[model samples]
Target: MYPDELERYHRQLLVIGREAQEKIRRSSVLVVGVGGLGSIASLHLAAAGIGRLVLIDNGKVELSNLQRQILYTVDDIGKPKVYSAAHRLSELNPGTSIHPIYADATPELLREVISGVDVVVDGLDNWETRIIVDKICYELGKPYVHAGIHGFYGQLYIAWPGKTPCLRCVFPRPPRRGNGDVIPVFSTTPGILGLLEANEALKIISGVGKPLLNKILVYDGKTGLFDYVEIRDADCRVCEE
Candidate 1:
């Protein structure tokens, strides 16, 4: 770490120590969406000195996004989300390298991107894409931190390839949704889940705390309560190789 980097991450170093901090500095992460959850998770990861971040999204900033997506402003409404987010993150931490991919997360792209990253963080809104990501991460034997938010509720889990139940094990099939249907969400739902995603990633990278492992954490913002569910391995094609 350089003198400026040391000074910039001094407070975190006090908590995680120099060795753990160095581990964080050398880690690379792949974030598959740049919407509400991705925006907040990537922001904290960059600030925490992640060595590299690969951001993927195929959308532009919109006025409606202002309600929950904190990465953009009104002036950025027309710009690509990946570009705008990369710019903001770079400004926050020049020491961390940011790679913005402006495209949908296809299986081919996911395999390529996941190959190089140390961990995969889910910021996706749809189950189709999330399932694809989870499958690829399991195939590649990478750690994946998954989180989903909807209408003042959220769920989080960390999937470890062979050690823990994969996402497919948890959700054998995705819930039904009509095409082009909009999901209702509270402004702070993603904020809370995104921070939890970042926190879990940091724990995995720095070896400081226990990763979520085989537990699914659920939060209900309506009642401000959090609950945990234990996950056991089942006959899942993705991880039952």
Candidate 2:
């Protein structure tokens, strides 16, 4: 390890030190969706020294995205998210390598990119895509950190394929249209959930903290309450019980 690396991550390396720092340096993470949640999650992972980051987002930065999408600013309104994120990530952590796949990367698209990554972060907004990726990840025996936000309340969970329950274990199928309706979210809603997702990702990468495996942490921004519910269903299709 270089002297500056130790100095750069001194706070985190304080407890785990060089060994864990090296682990982070050796691992890769695939962040699907460069929207609000994906944006923040990718930023934190890069800054934390994750070896390689593969960004997959098909959308362009829109004016409405500025309120919470921290990765892109006003000048980035029309640029594609994957390109913008890749550029910003490189600038944020020159030590890390970023692979930007600027396409409509779904589960199939993820196959090639995921073969070498350590963990997956679910930053997408659609449940259909989430279910598809969840199935593939669970089949591949990968760990994933997931989050969803609506209004001030959001939920996060960590699932280790076959061991902990998968996303489908909690929600068997994507909610049908108009089922839950459109849950409104403040600009910071995705930011909060995304930050929690980053915390979980760091814990998984460093092996220095316990992740939210098997439990869904629900946060209510208004009350500032965080409650957890154990996902005990072992008969889930995606999780393969």
Q: Which candidate is the best by lDDT?
A: 1
TM-scores of the models, in the given order? 0.96, 0.92
lDDT of 2 by residue, 78-156 (tens): 9988998999999999999999988886667887777778899988888878877777788788888888877787888
Reference-based lDDT, each prediction: 0.91, 0.83
Q: Write the per-residue lDDT of candidate 1 for residues 1-241, one digit (tens) a residue.
A: 7899789999998898899999999999999999999999999999999999999999999999999999999999999999999999999998899999999899999999999999999999899999889989988999999998878889998877867778888867776554557878899999999999999999999999888887889999999999999875534554565
lDDT of 2 at 212: 75
Native-to-model Cα distance after best TM-score fit, residue 19 in candidate 1, in Å? 0.7
Off by over 4 Å in 1: 176-180, 234-241
What local lDDT does model 2 show for residue 165?
Answer: 74
Name the lDDT value of residue 18 in candidate 2: 82
